[model samples]
Target: MKTSISKAVAPVAFVLALAFTLLLHGAVPFWGTPTLGQAVWTTGFSHSFVNHGLLPYAYDFGAPAPASIAFGLAGAYPAALLIALGMHPADAYAAMVALWLTVAFVSAWWLGIRAGAGSVKSTLAALAWVTMPVIWAHSGYSMLSTGIALLPFYSLAACMLFLDDVQGSRKIGRALLYLSSCLISVFMDGYSFMMFAMGSSIVAAYSFVMNHSTRRRLLTYSLPVHIAGFSLAYVLFALYIGKPSFGAAPLDFFRGWGADVTFFLFPTQGIHWMWDTLGLSVPRSHRELFGDSSVWKTTYLAPLLIAGLLGWLFTFSKSRIASAALIIAVAGLYLSLGPSLKFNSLVPQEIIETGVNMQHMPAELAIAPTGSALLSEHLPGFKNMRASYRWVALAAFGLWFLLLLWLSKAETLGARSAAAILCLAVIGSNLPHPQRYLEIPASNRAQFKAIDTMLVDDMREALQPGEQIAFLPYRNDFLVNYLAPSVPIRTYNIGGDKNLAMARENWPKTMRQFKMNKVDPAFADRLLWLLAQGEADAVVLPYIDMLWAAHAWPGGKIHQKQVQPAIDRLSATGLVDIDTREYYAVVRLNATARVLGQTALQAKLRQTLCLPGFCVRQAASSNAIHSRVGRLSANTLKSDGRRGFLVFGPYEPVESGTYLLVVWGRAPVPAGAWVDIVSSRGSTVHAKFSVPRTASRPDNILLEEKVVFDEAVDDLEVRIFAEEGSRIAITGYELRLARSGPDKD
Candidate 1:
C-alpha cells in the first residue's frame, strides 16, 4: 500500500512543478535586459538567414565570421521559425523558454529514476533540481546559461554507458543516448559543454578505478561516441571562426570570477529575506559579493536538502557511489573557491586604511592562494576557465545522486514519510518569491510597435541596396535589434573600444588624418567625406538625449550634452536630412563636397552674431555690444573685473584666401586689448591695439586686421583678450573672406 502511494507521487510532483514553472515564466515573457536584447538579435539573425538565405555567421559588427557560433542556435532557430510563422518575437522567445523548462523537468526525473530512487523521492529530486534558485536566477539574466537545465539527463546517459549496468542492445542504446546528449548540450551553450566535459571526466575516472571491465567498455563504446560528437562540433566551429584556439583570456579573469566561500553560507537577497527576519545579520559587503557572484551561488543547497544529503552520508558511508559523490563534491567546492582564499573580515593593513573594512566579522580568519590558482598558472587550458563557480553544476549533480541513493536504501514507511517532508522543505527553501519576476520591467506592446515602425520600417525604406549606414554615438543594442535582418544595409558603430580599434585598422588613412587635424571640426567633415565617398550611404543620429534620460546611468549627462551639438553641426553640412523626427534624424549626402563645405562655412559665419557676452543687444537686427563688470545679464553672461579671453569659431575654412576682420569700438578711457586669429593647421596671427583716451567720450575707434591662409585650413580659432578694468564696448564686428579658387562659392 505504501509502495503504491509512493509510485504515484513522482508523476504528480513532476506535473505540478512543470505547470508552476510554465505559469511563472509564460505570463511574464521578458525577464533580463541583456538576455532579452541578445534574444532579439538572435531572432533577427535567424529570420535574415531563413528569408534572405544570408550566411548565419556573417555579422554587421566587427567579428570575423561565426562569433556567435559558440552561442549555438538551439533556442534561436526555433524562435526564428515561430517568427516566420507570424508569431511575435517576444511570444516566440517565451515558447522556447517553456520548451526548455519541460525538457529540464523530464530529464531530471529520468536521472532520479536512474539513480534508483522511489517514485516520491525521484519526484522530489527532479523538483529540487528544476526549481533551484541558481537555475532560475540564471534564466532571468543570462538565457544562455539556462542550458545547465540539460545536465541531469546527460548525467543519466553517462551513468548507463560508463557503469556497464546494462548489457547487449541496452548498452548500445545507452551509448547512443549519451552521444546525443553530448551533441545537444554543445548546441545549447559553451558553458554547458564545459560542464558536461568536467562531469563526464569525473564519471570516467570513477568507472576506471572501480572496474577494469568498465574501463574496457568505455574505450570501446564511450570513446568513439565522444570523439564523433566533438569532431562534428569542431568542424562546424572551424567553418565559421577559421581556427579554434584557447588561452585568449588572462589568468586574472579566472581568479576574479571564482566563487567565494561566503556564497554557500548565505543565500542571495531573494532568499536572504527569511534569514534577515530571523535576526541573522548579513554583511553589506558580503551581500554585494553575493550579488556579483549570482551564478556561483548555485553551490547553495537549501538547509533541508543539505540535511538529507548529510543523513544519507552518515547512513551509507561505506557505499561506493556515496564515497565517489563525497569526493566529487569536495573537489568541486575547492575549485569553485578560485585561485585565492579570503574569508569575510580578513584584510591587509593597506586595504584597511582605505576604509574598505570587512563586514559581519568572525574571530578566526585567514587569506591564502588556492589550489585552483596554482593549477591555472601552470596548466595550458585551465587559465581559459573564467567562471570557476560554474563547477557547482557538477557538484549539484553528484549531491542529488547521493541523496537519492540513500533514500533508495530506506524501505520503511517512517523513512519514506521523513523523506517526503524533507523534499517539501527543499522545495520551500529554494522557491523564489513572486517579487523576483517583477523586479525587471516587462516590455509593453506599444514599445515593440514603436521599435518596428520608427526604427525598422524607416531603415528599410531609406537605405538603398548595398548601401551601409553608421549611427552617430553608436549603440550596439540598436544595431543588433533593428538592422540584423536588413542584409542589404551594413551597419557600423563607434560604440565599443574594440569597434573603434577595428575602424582605425580598416581606415588607417582617414583615422590618421582625423587624429592629426582639428579633432572636433574635422570630425564632421570626415564623416561627410566618408559618406560622399560611398563608404556609407547615410548617418543616423538618434535622439540620444531622450534615450539616455530614459535609461540614465553614469556618463549619461555628458553623452546628452554631446548629442545635440554633433547633430546641429552635421545638419549644417549640405547633407540632406531625409528623415527628421523628435526621436532621430537621418542625414544623407546630397551635394558636391565643395558645395557642402561652403554651406558649412556659411553656417559658421551666421553664428558669429550669437557670441554670448560680447554681443549684448539686437538693435535694427544687428548685435549692440555692452561691456560691464560684476553685473549678470538675463543670459547669464557676466564679466569679472579681471583679465579674460573669449574664443569663437573652431571653424573649418571653405577655401584658401585672405580674410579681413574689423572691430569697431569706443572706450570711456584708454585700455589695451589683443586679437588673435589662430589656425589649427598654420601659425597664429596676433594684433594689438589701444583704445585712445579722450577728453570727450569717443564715438567709435576702427581696428582692422588682415590674415591669410595658404590652403583651405581645416579649423580656425578666433580669440579676443581684454585687459583688466578695461571699459570697452564693441558696436560692430565683420569678417570678409576672399575667394581664391574657382570652386569657391
Candidate 2:
C-alpha cells in the first residue's frame, strides 16, 4: 500500500511549514515587515494613548475601533521584547511563505492518503501542491502575518471531508473543531479565508455527488451549524468591530462589475469596494490594476492556476469531486458578478417607489454564503475579510484534492498516467492564463522623502516656542498627521474623509479642486487674491485626488494657473513649495522645524490647545475687567450686590502651572476702587492700588479684594463672593493675569 510515502508527506509538510515560519519571522523579529493592507491598519493602532484605556477614536482623531484589534499586530514589539523573539518580521514572512506551502502540500497528501491512493501517490501529490502554480505564488510571497495559521485550519477541514465517522462525542467534537477552525480562519484575514472557503466548498459538493452517503452525513452534521456560526461570527465582527454602515450612494453599481465571472456568479461592477468603506461598484478594468503589487504577486501561487490547469485534464475524468469542484469554481465567480449585474444605482428608477431607492447590493446583501456553505474551504485569515472569493479557493482545493484521490485510486493504471501528469504540469507552466499582475514595489511608497527634509528644515528655522505655524489647504490629518509624528505641526482638521475647514480656509482654490478638478484662471486668480488677504504659515494646494471625484472636477487649467503658481511664489514673508514629494501638496507650514523643535511651548499645552497638529487656539492674558449686567428681578447696581460675573479671564497660560487668585467682596454702595498685586517673587508687595471702590465712580463692574497670589498659577482670577453671600453675582468680570511686574514699570 506504500504507506511510507504517505507517512513522509505529512512530516515533510510539517517541517516545511516550520521552516517557512522561521523565514517569515525574518532577520529582525521585532522589526518585521508589516502585512499587506496593514499600512492602513497601522494607523488604527494609535488609540492606546488615552488617560482612560479606550477612547472614541484612534489618535483621538477619528471614529473609534474596537480595542485590542490593531494593537495585537504591534504585539511583536512587546512580544519580541518579552519572550525570546524568535523571528524578525522578515523571517516571519519567510515562514509564512513556507507555512502556506506546507499547508497546501499536507492538504494534497491527506486527500490522496484518505482516497485509498498508495502512500507513494499521496506523497507525490503533496509535492505537487508544494510547487503548485498559485500556491507557489503564496509561498514566494506571503501577505498576512498569520499566514502560518492556515495549516491547522486546512488540516481540520480535510478531516471532516474524508474521514468516515460513527459515534456521539467524536461527531460532536469534529463539528466543534470544524466550526472553531472556521472562526479562526476568518479572524486571521477574512479575505484569505474567503478564498479558503470557496475551495473547501468545492470538495463538499464533490463529496455530495461521489460519496452520497458520506455527503449526507457531512451535510447532516455540518451545514446548519457551519452556516449559523459563520454568519454570527461575521456579523459580530462587521457590526461591532468594523462598524460598517451604509455609505453614501453606490455610484458604481450601474457600471458592469466585470466580465471574468469565474470567481463567482456575481457581476464584477460593484466588487472594487466589496469590503471597503465605500462598498460601491468598481470598474472591471481594475481586475489587474496592481494597486499594491505585492498582493498581486501573491495571487499567482495557486499551483493549479490557469497556466497549469491543463495538467489535470488526464485525472479530471476519474475524479468526480475534482470535476464538480471545477464547475463550482466557475459558479463562484458569478457570485460577485451577480451583484454587479444587479447593482442598485442610488438613482431611483420608475419601477421603484420614488425616494425609496433600495441601495442594498451584492456587498450589502448576502451572496457568497449560499455558495460558500457548499463549496468553501477554511482559509486562515478568511475571517478578517468578507467572504467573497472563498468559494473559488474551495473549488480549486476540492479539484486538487480529488486529483490526488484519483491518483491514489489508480494503482492499476501504472506509471504512464503519472508521467503524463508530470508532462502536463511542465507544459502547463508556459500556457499562461493566470498571469500575475505587474509589480512595481515603488508604487507602495509615495515620493515624500524630499519634502520631508524640506519640511523639517523649514520648521527648524522659523518656529518659536509659543508661535504656531498653521498649514492651510491640505488635510491636516493626512499631511500633518503623517508628517508631524515627532514635530509639533498643527492642523485645522483631522481624519474625516475630507476636512471641510481646510477647504473653506483655502476656499477659492479648494472649491475648484474638489468640485471642478480643473485649473481655471479665474479660480486661480481668486486663490491668489485670498492668499494676499493675510500671511499664513503656508497655504497648500490641491493634488490629483481633488479631481478624482466630482468635487474636484475642473482640476486641469485651474490647478496650473491658480494652484501651482500660488505655491511657487516665495515672497520674503512667505515661500511657495511643492509637497508632491509626499504624494500630496499643501502650503508651507513653519519657517523651520528646528525653530519649532526648540520652542518655549509646553508639550502638554500643545495637546490641550492644538487639535492633533493644528493650532486652533492659544493662551494669552491681559488687564481690564469689562462687565455687562442683565436685569434680574432686583435689577441694576441694586440688592446686596449678589450678581453674576460675565467674566473673560487670562487665557490659559502656555505653560500650565498654577496660582489661584480670588476676586470677592461686597460692592460698597459706592466705594473707591483699589487694585493691588503681590510680587511673583515677593509676598504682598503692593503693585498698584486705586482708592477703594468709592461712591463717586459708581462703575458698572466691581473687582474683589484679597486678590492673593499665594502660589504659581495655572488659571487667572477666580470670582469671589461678598463676605457672607453666595458666588460672585456680578454681571460680568475680566481677570488680568500675567508673568509678573508692575504696569508701566
Candidate 3:
C-alpha cells in the first residue's frame, strides 16, 4: 500500500465506522434518538449544561462534591455542545455515540499501523475490534462505551512516549498526547483508566528491566507525563471531589458478579445470532448450569481472537511489549475471577470418589476465598472497586494488541492464509443480526411526557432560583430530568449514579407513613425534618414518571399505589401552594413551612432518637453513605429464641443533665426485655430498665428509666437487650431533659 494512501485510510475508515454505527441502530429518526437506560442520564446532563451551565458537584447517590469525580462529563460535554448548536438532546446523544465509536475505530487502526501491521490487515483488525459483541453489549451505557473507545488512544500515546526510537520533537508531541490522554481518562471512566494504569505499570516494569533504551525513555518523557498527569488529577479531585477512590463494593457482590472462565472463550447467549439461528441451546443452558444469572457474561473474546491468542502463546518471543501483553492479560483474567476461583462457572474443591478410585469432578470443586476477595475486603483501591469482572477490559485490549503485533510478522503465503481464515471467522462470529438492532426503542418514547406538555415559562415562574425540588420516586427522576434544564430548576436528585439507593427499595415504608388516613405524626415529623435537612423547597410527584417507570422499572407499581396518598397528605399539611397537573403535581414549600419544619426538627433532634436496624449496615458497601440523607429505611429486627442485643447505638446527649428515657416498643412473646445506657468505649452499663410484660399497643412504650449524667459525656450509647423467645418490636426512643440544673448529691 502507498504511504499517502495508508495515511488517508484512518479518516476514510472512520466514515465507514460511523455509517455502520448509524445503520446498526437502524438510523436515528428526528423525533427520537437511539438511546435508552443509562444513556438518558448523560443526555439529561447535557441538556442541563446547555440550558443552565450546571455542573453537578454531587452525583445521584453520592454526597455533594465536585463534578470531576464522576464519569458523565466525558460523554456529556460533546452532547451538550451539539445541543447548543441546535440539535435535539436525543439526537445529540446518538451522534455522541457515533462519534466516540468512530474514534475508537480510527485510534485502533492508527495504533495497528504504528505497530508495523500492513494497512489492509490493520484496517480489518480495527473493524473487527469495533464490531465485537462486547462493544455492542455496552451500547446503552455511554460512559463505559466511551471509555472503551478511548482505550486504544491512551495505549498509542503510551507506546509513542516510551519508545527509545522516537526522539526530539516527536518525543515532546507524544508527551503532550500522553498528558491529554491521562486527563481524558480521569474525566471519562475512572475504572477503565485505573485498569490502563495497572496494565501500563506491568509493561513499563518489564521494559525497564529488559532494555537500556526503554529505561532511559521511561526516566525522561514517561516520568514527566506521569508527574504532570497524576498531579493534575490529584489536585482537581482533592479540590472538588475530595479523595479519588472507586465506589466501595461488597465482597459478596464482587464474587457474584465476577467473570467466569468459560465466558472468555464463548459468546454470551443473546448477543450472537448463531445461538438462536443454529438451534444452539448449549450456550444458554451451560451458563445457567453453574451460577446465578448475576455472573457477568459480557467479557467474551470471540473464537477468532481466542484462537489467535492461543496460537501466539506457542510462537511468542522475548519481545518486551509482547511478553508484557501476555502478563497483563493473565493478571487481568486472574483479578477478574474475583475472590473465588471459578472455572466454567463452577468452583473446584473436593475430589469425587468412585469405589476407592478417586476422580476429580469440576462440579464438586470450590474455592471460597480468592486473593481478590481478601484484597477487596482490606485494600483501599481493591475494596472500592467492587466489580472485579471489569478487569476483563484490560485483558481484551492486551489480547487485541498482541494479536496486532503477531499479524505484523506474517509475510509468507501460509501465514497470510491462516490470518485470513481467522479474520473471516471473527467477522462471521461477531456479526450482529439486523433484527437485534431493530429491537432498540426510540428515545423520544422513553422521555418524560410532562416535558412536552408542561409550560416551561409557567414552571419557571412557580420556582425561584437556587430553590431545590425533591422528586418522589427518586429513581424515575432521571427520565424526567431533561425538564430541569428547560425550566432551569435546581433539584435534590442526581442523575447517572447507579450506586445510589433505589427509591422503590427504600420508600414503601416511608410512603405508608405519609398516607393521609394512617399517618404517623412522629414519622411525618421526622420526614419533614429530613426534607428540611435536605434543603428541599418543593416536592414534585411526577405522575407521568410513575406511569413510564411502571413499564420500564422495578418499582412502578408501588410508586403508583403510594404517590396519590402522599399527595393527599401533602395537601393536608396546608403549608404550601399545590399546582396539580394532569401528568404531575408540584407541592411548593412556603417560607413559613420551611421555618416551622426547621424549628420542629431541631426540637425533635434534641430529645427523641430512633435507631436503625443492624441490617442497614449492609449499605456500607455502597457509596450512598457519603450523602447526609442517604437511604437507611425503617426496618424491624427479630430474634429467634436467643438472648441478644437487637439494637445498639452510640447516641450522644445534647447536654449533660437528668433525662427521662423511654423505649417505645412491644414484646409479643411476653418475654423479658430491658434497656441499657452504656458507655460507647468501655463495656459499662450506667443505667438499666427491666420491665415486665403488659397489655399495650404493638408500638407502645416497653421500658423507661431516669438516667443522670453529671458532666459532658461524649461516648454514651443505648443497647436494647431481649430475653430468649422474645419477639420485640422497637419503634423509637424518647430522651427528654427532666431538669436543667446539674445533679445534686
Per-residue lDDT of candidate 1, residues 372-406 (tens digit): 76666675334545566666666665666666665
Rank by lDDT, descending?
3, 1, 2
lDDT of 2 by residue, 1-745 (tens): 5566657675665555434333322212223322222221222233122212333222322211123232123222222222223432233332333444455456556656666665455665555444332333332223333432353245446457344465788767766766765665554544445555555565565666677667667677666646655676566545533443212223222112221233222223321222222342233332232112222222221334432243246456665444654564455444423223322223224424443323222333322223332221233332222323222333444445445555554445554486437534522431222212112112211222222354435544443322223333333233333233223333232322322332334333222232233343233333333233332344445443321211112223333334555454433223233345233354443344224432332232233222211111212112233233212323222224334333333323212222123233234432223334333322434334342342223454344332323343333332221222222233333333332222231
- Give the count of colliding residue pairs in each prediction: 0, 158, 8
Cα deviation of 91, candidate 1, in Å: 1.7
TM-scores, each model vs. reference: 0.68, 0.44, 0.73
lDDT of each: 0.54, 0.36, 0.58
lDDT of 3 by residue, 243-305 (tens): 455457555666756776767666655667765566542344422333333234457765644
Please give the ranking of all candidate structures by TM-score, highest first, separated by commas. 3, 1, 2
* Top-lDDT structure, candidate number: 3
- lDDT, candidate 2, equals 0.36
Per-residue lDDT for 234 in model 2? 60
The positional error of residue 359 in candidate 1, measured at the CA in angstroms, is: 19
| Model 3 stretches astray by more than 4 angstroms | 1-14, 22-34, 51-69, 223-235, 281-295, 310-320, 346-380, 438-466, 473-477, 480-483, 496-523, 528-534, 542-557, 564-585, 588-745
